[model samples]
Target: MLVALLLLVLALSNEVRVNGERGGRQCGANPSLKPRPHSVSILEFGAVGDGKTLNTLAFQNAIFYLKSFADKGGAQLYVPPGTWLTQSFNLTSHLTLFLEKGAVIIGSQDSHHWDVVDPLPSYGRGLEVPGGRYQSLINGYKLQDVVITGNNGTIDGMGLTWWESFRSHSLNYSRPHLVEFVASNDVVVSNLTFLNAPAYNIHPVYCSNVHIHNISIFAPPESPYTVGIVPDSSDNVCIEDCTIATGYDAIALKSGWDEYGIAYGRPTENVHIRRVHLQASYGSTLAFGSDMSGGISNVVVEDAHLYNSKGGIEFRTTRGRGGYMKEIIISDVEMKNIDTAISATGYCGSHPDDKFDPNALPLLDHFILQDMIGTNITIAGSFAGLQESPFTNICLSNITLSVNYASSTTWNCSNVFGFSDSVFPKPCSDLDNPSNYSSSYLSMLSMKGKTMVSGSVSMKK
Candidate 1:
């Protein structure tokens, strides 16, 4: 059962009546309902119950009323503007929130308003506090064919208070996700601005056929944000023409590594992120890792612009994770003032342990980086031999990098092949020693008179 159903039952049991609206009634109270019936509109249950202003309790009542159709077919929730203050809303299948211009859905400042029963499978073991732990402003469940769009209005979390509290708290403190889609399908969020979020801005977890377009997410620069959009181990997710200004990775995919085992080794693949503009994030502009317990592959990013970002185009993995990242193509990437233009790091370092075995570990292979242009890449290229693994089957071609800050790129050459146009790693003896490597691996690197040295650039294969 969804938490929305629980909230509705609680609301009905309390007999919290507002105006002529009754519990267990449709928008107009017709029991003989059919698929694709007349579209019902909700506008009479705000602060004034007259559709003029925001009645917080009235709006909450309306939300509970909307949950009755969670298991039904198609419906629409219409909001014609004014400030609608309420707790979290659970979206149903075949449902859409069509906001007329000048509309705003503001979440309550108090956390208790969002308190609802847990909706997980287990009671007290697999998750914390069961279904009550999962909460969001607009939560869509395993439904299909849903759209949440607004022309010029905003979906404000009113999360300034939550942000302040999170910053004041410790790193172990967990916060609620703002807008989440769990196991849902065919969802689209377009032409809206999500501002001042409590946690991750927009998350589509364990979902497929998801599209998020033309969204503008803005949070304070000082906020210790985690991610703007997290496509967590979900497939067929597309994010395009979005502007993100935050304190963390613009987009990331996370799956609990040691926490979630190999039985659930599915990765976030078949993802396309294009035409995204990111500015001033604490993490990477477009990245994978951090939560690589599930693995990621077949991801493509094109026509992206980054400004003053901490990092750019990161691929990372750690020891406890059993996932692999492969067949990633990043092209037409332009950047300025980024922490690094390209970086790949492993959680298992140069020392081999139980977690570092090429035979059983995930492979990073068939990566293509083309038509990349950047200025002042801050970090040096990562060709260092880790205790666990080194890069394999990678290609970087047609790259034009200009370093206005420094001279020469860096390379350790112990594991990478086909590296050209280089400046540093003076002797390049790591490539000369064949016994330390496979037969033809060291013969594939060429780094002479390609471009002037800045930080460093290396291509691994």
Candidate 2:
């Protein structure tokens, strides 16, 4: 009996190790690429954490050393407990930037000191304006096996200046994010607290095999355009167990903008988002597009909670933005105090310019929402497709939502085709009757937990 117990313990340990390595493997990182035995604190590079001194050069010199050490098995740059004031700094590959508890990295308020990068090829211009974009507080490019984790350390972007400039239409370029990884692969960002980003909090663009978990992100509800996490034109990404309270969408997926995006066709695919708590002051909990002309597919959002958000699950695209969005699955969601429980519109936001082709209509199909519950919602569901190209093959089952007493409780659907079963507020006539659904249709709906995209992808749960 004792021998059997020992064997069982060994088996359990092996299982835990395997599970932990799954993320590392997906990110192209392995134990063999571990950081060198040497660890250096920022103080060693003459960094002063008095919260007033400029530490940009110190950070730069330290990262330069680590970059040179990349061939020497990499290195770890440690940020000790204090407020470190610095401008944007580039990160090196095969390195770890670990922040101790109580450590804070504060972005410098001087805008002129920030670095500027060219606009994205897919956007043809900055997303907000028509010029270059300011680099993020912690920016990386074309890196591999990079990890940013800490004991819930804070990275604060002093964005009030940028916000004022935007509201007053005095900005020449787009604001910077709190953290951004561009053209990077095998990245992991976890256990950090992000606050007051000028634009998006976390953005990973043109990257693949990224993992983000156990992070808390926040910004003032009144702050404009402060999105939480945006994965753009990337693949094989996973985001789990995070809390996001921001001004815009808690999590927005994107590929590219209008005509420029169609020319540079790189789609965002195979993303998994689970166990997320989303709160938005002015936007949706989970959103896609408003700028997705490069296409987005095979996304699974499950086990999410939303509070005081404008929309719960939303998809937005306009006539001039041509993209295909399909195979999206949302399951086991609970929402409270939301304006709209579900929304899909093809004419929500405006185009970048009149030069865009009006014939570039979006295509949407194979959307499924299941096992959802909502309370104090303004509208149970509002789905509006384009008159020229209607949405198709939407499915909803096992949904129960309560409309606010002061609001009309109804499901408004137009220019879409789909079916519903055991759904509240009764779906529109475009959907087939629940009783008339075939057994195969029922079986497909029942397979919600097994596969999010018809055997293409499986989530870790």
Candidate 3:
């Protein structure tokens, strides 16, 4: 077990190195978007961009007409500078939807105009409600080579009404997202500004080779459950060079939910997030799971600036969540004015139903946090792991968190163990005992009733 775990860590290290060395601003050399063979303007299909007319059918017909070019190198649908108000529109495969500067596609405020869809197989229900969800403004499913790029174009989900309804508990279904892509591959969304989403700004679920870059996503700080980017049950996702400020989690990496998620049995893995600025007024700047019964692993987050967050980095799971979160590395992070710099709790989120396995324990291990610095933090760290499955092999190196001296407790820990190297304000004794991990790779293991990091991997200061 030890050898296998070490090999996984080393292999992850090598993968990170390769990804970091890739040239150009693209995600793994994301091919430069070339011009499509055929192009059409929305006006060609008699779509008015007055921001008042419901152009839902105009947009649909335009895409239907473009379906002819699917086999002939695909096509492009260009939306010139104007406010194009519409409901939800599904994108076709091998298509590029480009928006010129000052172009805005607005989601209609009429809730009845939106389409309702069945809940995800993993969740078994809508995320906030117990039934179907309003479809996203722009959606792509089972697609290949789809790009939604623009010259800083905008997709606005005027969600104030939705937010009010949600707060009043007056909604019959879950709110909609600004953009979502499900079960899709080779998708790219860049150079856009997303605002006032009913829920999430951008969501990619059950997808692969998804790249989201050079985008700004935001919602009102008072908006409830407004996430910025959610990568759920998705693999090979690259989210970088983005700025996101949301009412809730800036980025939540999830797999599945409880029994339904476990039944799906597909883990979200091999993800990379870098070079981003994130702010969450009421949630974590970055988070992993509360509904991750399908498992999440092999993620790397580096060169990030997290500021003004309720929590900086958090790992949330409940008793009934049967999954694992492991082989993750967070490095080169700078935090400011954070309520909690780091937290890992086995208590958060709700269950889909009562058919969850109470004995299904979630594993949390091999999390390496290195080269982190924080200032004006209320609490330094809190590690609350499960007694049945205590978190282990959490290696912290060169972490300096400037916490409030007036606060009674800077760090709180229980049922967790690891090696802490040069952490400021000192972590709890459960993990403060540091070994020279600078020259050794580590794996998940605890022997003789003592939890610690043990292996042979090199880390630089």
Model 3: how far residue 113 lies from native, Å = 0.5
Q: Itemize residue pairs with steric clashes in candidate 3.
A: 440-457, 441-456, 441-457
Candidate 2 lDDT: 0.81
> Against the hidden true structure, what lDDT does model 3 obtain?
0.84
In order, how many clashes per candidate? 25, 0, 3
* Candidate with maximal TM-score: 3
Task: Estimate, for each residue in 335-369, the C-alpha lDDT of model 3 and write its tens digit.
Answer: 99999999999988888878899998899977878
Worst 10 residues of 1 by lDDT: 446-455
Cα displacement (Å) at residue 376, model 1? 3.3
The 0-to-1 C-alpha lDDT of every candidate, in the order given, reads 0.58, 0.81, 0.84
lDDT of 1 by residue, 255-332 (tens): 434334344555676666677898756777887765565667656566789878877877776554556776665667
TM-score of predicted structure 2: 0.89
Locate the minimum summed-lDDT window of 10 residues in model 2: 452-461
Q: For model 1, what is the C-alpha lDDT against the true structure?
A: 0.58
What TM-score does each of the candidates earn?
Answer: 0.73, 0.89, 0.91
Taking all chains together, the TM-score of candidate 1 against the true structure is 0.73
Candidate 1 local lDDT, residue 110: 72
Kindly report which residue stretches of model 3 are placed more than 4 angstroms away from their true locations once superposed: 1-19, 23-26, 434-461
